[model samples]
Target: MPTKSLTHPVRTRASRGDIAVLYTVHLDTSHPTTGCDVSPAAVHEEYVVTRVTSVAADGAVTSVQDTRWSYDNSSRSLQDIPGVAKIFVIPQDRVDVEAALATAGAHTYPDTTVLRPYATMDEVCDAINPHRH
Candidate 1:
């Protein structure tokens, strides 16, 4: 029997008057095990974006973009855990990009202390590495 494990909800919304951009992250894990357990684990992460047509009407959805990342670790090693950094090129006007990103920063995972924006995955990794200095 497989066990249902970790679930994380991440949501972000940015709006200027009637138009809005929303971003969300969903993580699901199955067959997870602790260090003492001798089983493997599977994890999936979903990233979604929804463009709002109107804020007054409870933010009707005008467009959406969804992407996913997944990994399997049978070694039961903590270092095998997958990294979850994604770059989304939203097709909105240039004026809206900053506001949208600001909203994303405000609604990131509570445990995250720093929310620096990066242009590439390598930059993100470098910023988070403790030994980078």
Candidate 2:
């Protein structure tokens, strides 16, 4: 994942060059490592946003911009979305967009990227790289 710190431009509003996060409620994964598991291991699966998109748009999403800060690992990889790219025309429904969004996390750094509420780097490292070993 990218830094948990907000870059301001990363607000959830799907704008050009903005990293839009898609919340996956439960994604079955075949992670390369056993310690990489994100499953709940019990009730509901974990809610996570792995991939992010830096969209390009005029009035609405038009393309995926190749942003340098968009990735650091597999989970933070940028997705190439053809449907919303400038090459294809998709209808915009502002009302639906408004209805679908719920802003979370505190904005910091600048209005360059919005970091969603997630575990801090130290917390994450502690979880994945447990001391039990």
* The best candidate in terms of TM-score: 1
For model 1, residues 18-84, the per-residue Cα lDDT tens digits are 2222222223345655666534233333333223322223422323221111123111211222342
Identify the runs in model 2 with alpha carbons over 4 angstroms from their true place.
Answer: 1-12, 27-39, 42-133
Please, what are the lDDT tens digits per residue for candidate 2 over residues 38-129?
A: 54542222212122233444333323322223443322232433122112111122112222122222222366565432224333222222
User: What Cα-based lDDT does every candidate model obtain?
Assistant: 0.30, 0.29
Candidate 1 similarity to native, TM-score: 0.25
Q: In model 1, how large is the Cα lDDT of residue 85?
A: 38
Error of 1 at 7 (Å): 28
